[model samples]
Target: MKITHYLYNAFLIESGDKKLAVDPGGLMFYYFRFSPLIPKSEWNNVTHIFVTHGDPDHYWHADRMAAVSKAPVICNKTMVQEIDGKYLLLGPRDKGVAFTTEFKNHHKLSVDETIEVDGVTITGIKTTHGPLTVKLGPFSKTLNPGRDERIGWGAIGFKIQLDGKTLVNLGDTLLHKDEWESIDSPDVLMIPIGGNAVHNTMDIPEALQAIRIMKPKLVIPCHYNCPAFFSKNFNHADEDEFRNELEAMDIQYAILHKGDSIHV
Candidate 1:
């Protein structure tokens, strides 16, 4: 199988004619910062679209991709809810999304749920979204970080089994209690390593700790290099540090530039 990186957490996985894309982001918060990496011709045949969470950077063009491929959007139940504004219980805004789509081929899953697509099996893994924000000062002049709460409602990771190899993609999340221990070692793991006071994703130290626990054969980092204008808190740490740490620990890893491919 071959994997192609498409900036942020977006990835294109291909084995033979079966193509699966994860998180293909859309324009930057209605701006035009991010454009498509894979041509429409390629994404049109994607057999499955997987979304780890509902951030625009993670799920902007998914509905259209599903429409083109006629494949199911396999994701955690929270993602499915966001697709339809099910209960309007998403994000900091209690308000519901303006419009929604039916996505006739949607697949709503939960932690520990498993689904098979074509010949590949996808297992849902538990993941905690970044910390919630607490309003501070008048008119929300400041922000305070809340406790590390496992996003009980709206986030997830995936253990994908394709062509006898496993790939784990943990969307935007922080280190969770014992959650990393539950995932079996995969051939490759995609994790987040861009975090700080303004953000809730993992920093380098936490990522190294996760690797020590999961012990995957290879590791790839994601959820970084976002434009500051998109979200002030949107941040990224240096991958050089992560690369150096992996080398010191004797772990194999790859830092893919956009459109780069790797095989296992």
Candidate 2:
């Protein structure tokens, strides 16, 4: 299998004829102009799309990609709402919390729920998105995910079983040791390590703790050192130290920059 990393938790996993896209998002900050995380060149060939949450950096291009690729999108049930018999999806570019986009081919799953589609087995893993605070000079605003909020709405993790291998992706979430203890070693574990500076996901140490619990064979750290607002490295991490520690534990690790890939 070939796994490609696009900054911010976005990935393209390819095995056989399947081209799966995880969090095919774009840059969240409107002020800065940047290219799409998962470039458009691959959109038409994507076989399936998996969304972990509704964050812009994680979901901005989902609608467009699905429209172009005609791929089935798998996400949390809360992201879609049945209105007048039409299943409207949470708008990726809408102003606030609005279910405006429509995706005809989609599947929704709740925490701990499992579903099979086209020979692929997917299980929803429990996850909790932390409160995110954005600051600009003296003005600051905080958004929290809740029953009526959209900041971190429809948050979930995915345990995908395909090609006789298990891959786990924990999209921007805080550590859930008790809930994730049952998850045995997976071939690949895509985790976030930028929570300290942004207070939105697991930090390096917290991610390390999760690594120990999950015991994944190969670990790929993400959601750090990204471009947001006016900073090029908004969510910084000490990857060198992280690699050293993981290596000390005899764990395999890969630090993929944007546009990098690994084969396993």
Which candidate ranks first by lDDT, i.e. highest?
2
lDDT of 2 by residue, 1-264 (tens): 999999999999999999999999888683665458998998999999999999889898898999999999999999999998899999997867899999979999998999998778999999889998888889889888887887888999999999999999999899999999999999999999988878899999999999999999999999999988877787789899889989999999889999999999
Query: What C-alpha lDDT values do all the predictions have?
Result: 0.71, 0.91
Give each model a TM-score: 0.82, 0.97
lDDT of 1 by residue, 1-264 (tens): 888886667889898878989986654442346455355777778998888876556766777677788887787776444444443222321223322456767677788889887787998888776653423334332222222222323578899998888999988788874967877678999988876553557878888888899999989887676543435334557778789999999999988867788887
For every model shown, the clashing-pair count is 0, 0
lDDT of 2 at 40: 96
Cand. 2 TM to true fold: 0.97
Candidate 1: stretches off by over 4 Å: 30-34, 81-99, 131-153, 228-234
Residue pairs with backbone overlap in model 2? none
lDDT agreement of model 2 with the native: 0.91
